[model samples]
Target: GIFGARPYKTFYVENDQVTFATLDPNFKEAVKLSADWYKKGLIDKEVFTRGWGARDAVLPTNMGGMTLDWFGSTASYNSLSTGQIPGFEFYPMEPIQIKDGVKSVTVGRNTTPEIGWGISAASKNPEQAIKFMDWWFSEEGRRTWNFGIEGKHYTMVDGKPVFTDYVLKNPDGKGPLKVLQEVGAQVSGPGVQQDAEYEFQYSNDIAKQGFEMYMKDGNTKRPLPILKYSPKDIKELDKIMALVNQTTEEYMQKWILGVSDVDADWDTYMSRIQQNGIERAKEIVQQGYNHYNSVK
Candidate 1:
């Protein structure tokens, strides 16, 4: 509901075809709904004025209300507010259903993480480096990378790696993240990192509940494919979209803040967006997408 009813991106593929979704009908309806919600006081009055730190500034106070955020951080507040405010809690809600019988797709990560290890071409021992990287994905190496050494940071509990008190409940007042950094269990290196129980042990029960809810089948899915465009295509897209994105953000803010009526201003906004080269941007993205699928 922040931008629109439908998930909005510069471009997203639906039915294996690229679409300029910001100008699409579903997003138009979303703009209208945002306007309506703003008028009805469902949205924060200070939404536009507040910077990204709004979460930090607002959430600790009594005035803090609903927010759409990551499951882990969202649940952290419940623990943060524990002694300060009685009965203060935050939990994840299922994505709002805009239309009956249609499930909403929560934008999720690609299976292959964007970050990875790479050996330098000038490396003296490239073969040794390759072997070292390969070891991280192996069974024993995975356990070491994800859980640290046996009987130190973790121990076998019914053939599962369970974090010890050093990582879970630090003797000092350090949080799980800090302890994990010291213990070297949760570093972002090459590995599967399939240790679900690690997150459960670190996070509070509320966060665990939210994690379970979102991880259930059909609750989350990747929204876009990992499409790589040529440098020339990227340069062209960047030029076109810089102006187009500016226009879209301007109109979305205006509509959501009630500075202008969505019904009155939408046509002009669409014209401005098109004049800013949305069509050309779509064409470039489509070309890249088509090439991506053909190769696949």
Candidate 2:
């Protein structure tokens, strides 16, 4: 919810135009609120310096109360920190509202799959490779890919496939996720439809409950589609947005840290962003998005 106070991305398409909502009134309010929270010691002091291992550093030590992370990772902490922290429990909360009647939408998966497989042109067994790929989409193949081999990783319970003790309770002190990874189940990439049963059987009761709670009222929405840009356009965009993003992040962090007053520095920041070619960056993004939609 803290991060959701601002726009999800630096740039997003609105009404077919790439928009930089950082300058919006709501975003300004969010930045102001963050500064106020930091002053009141509400926000974490080490948030910026803690780096990626912040969760490992704070969560297990009982230093952090709550974290805004993925459902699986967050919920699993309840089990992972059982002995280290006597009563360490992480419950998934409902999406918080940014304003009185405006509920925030949790960003879900992307519009299109990110991973895919392809056959090489120089492959000797091209026909066999194609046949194997086609079989992966078949009913039995999907089941195997999602749930692993029957009687080995899972057993037929009544009519549905249930994970065996090997997956649910590994003897090597490894979690189900690790075991699943080792055995090559529940790791199917794009183009293979994952079975819901895998999730149902793998997740704990708390995780399952959280899943139902979050998906109840269209509380989630996919972000922008992965836009494909021409080679030249991509190079141009990379050059422009990289510096723009750096400036944005620098100012945002400084404001949140109360190192600089947002209101006082707002004009200077805007001038810097303008000078950084933010307008040109937005145009490139707009063109890419339009081209993507047109092709689709």
Candidate 3:
């Protein structure tokens, strides 16, 4: 369960097996904590009653500061507040452990980078397109597209690319990334071969600091090998997850707001899903996990 969070859910993954623990004592504690906050008038008065846009409007007003969003989002919030707030900062903090020497935070995966250029079979300009694609992915072309001209946005220092002082210092009042954006410097995203080094250079100092904090402990779960799922399994998962997600959010909001008592209604909640093919859905996931390990 998350720290004093509403309607917290728990699942343990060990040796590639996944299982939920709604009846766990820790889950009960989290529910009680959330309810206590509501009772004491310490929580958002309209927490469960407002729509997303209205709820989010409170964050900028300092009504709610805590968030579960990632480093990039926190960086955006802090940067966007530059002229709006006085000395606002958000430093990413590592999670605290319930027990010493035990890690509790779950690690997730970033999309794997791969060489992905392809010319359309019906293209009239296939030859020219391929030539352009080749140059784009090349080292010299990538450096220029990602960092702009050397001696301008960046320069070579001891054979490694270094951002120039003007770029790093942002002397023109534009943020480092904004300045890079003006010059058509490539920003990493889907289908682009993300140059991690360029992204670090584009980010403001606070974001770079956050990145360092993420790497400081050096203890994180390495990604599992990419596994192919059968088309049948993929379709089944999509159908199951669609219903599961909608149901979970609706039920969770009720429980968190005390409209449904978690202790009294939790078993029925689990039973309802179990009757709706949860076992079969879980079997598919486990099979995929097994295949993932077996291939390597």
Winner by lDDT: 2
Ranking by TM-score: 2, 1, 3
lDDT of 3 by residue, 1-296 (tens): 23422123323345677544443455555666667777676678787666533324655566665555445434645643666566766666665564544443435444665224677899999989988878767888778776777888998988878888676666654445655767777544424555677666556667677677657554344444444579999899768766665666676677777788877877777777676556676677678778867877
* Model 2 per-residue lDDT tens digits across residues 165-219: 8877767545555566676766646566666667667677778778888777667
Q: Lowest summed-lDDT stretch of 10 residues in model 3?
A: 1-10
What does candidate 1's lDDT look like per residue over 1-296, in tens digits? Answer: 43434455447776776777776676777778778988998877888788755766677665677887655545666755546668887887765556764455466667665456889999999999999888878888778776777887888989888878876666764455556656665665553545555666667777777777877876665556666788998898888888987888888888888899888988898899789888888888888788887998
TM-score-best of 2 and 3:
2
> Which stretches of candidate 3 lie above 4 Å from their native place?
1-12, 20-59, 76-83, 99-106, 111-193, 216-225
TM-score of each: 0.70, 0.70, 0.62
Total colliding residue pairs, candidate 3: 0
Ranking by lDDT: 2, 1, 3
Q: What is the lDDT of residue 245 in candidate 3?
A: 56
Q: Model-by-model lDDT, in order? A: 0.72, 0.73, 0.62
Against the true structure, candidate 1 has what lDDT?
Answer: 0.72
Q: Cα miss at 183, model 2 (Å)?
A: 12
Off by over 4 Å in 1: 1-7, 101-103, 113-201
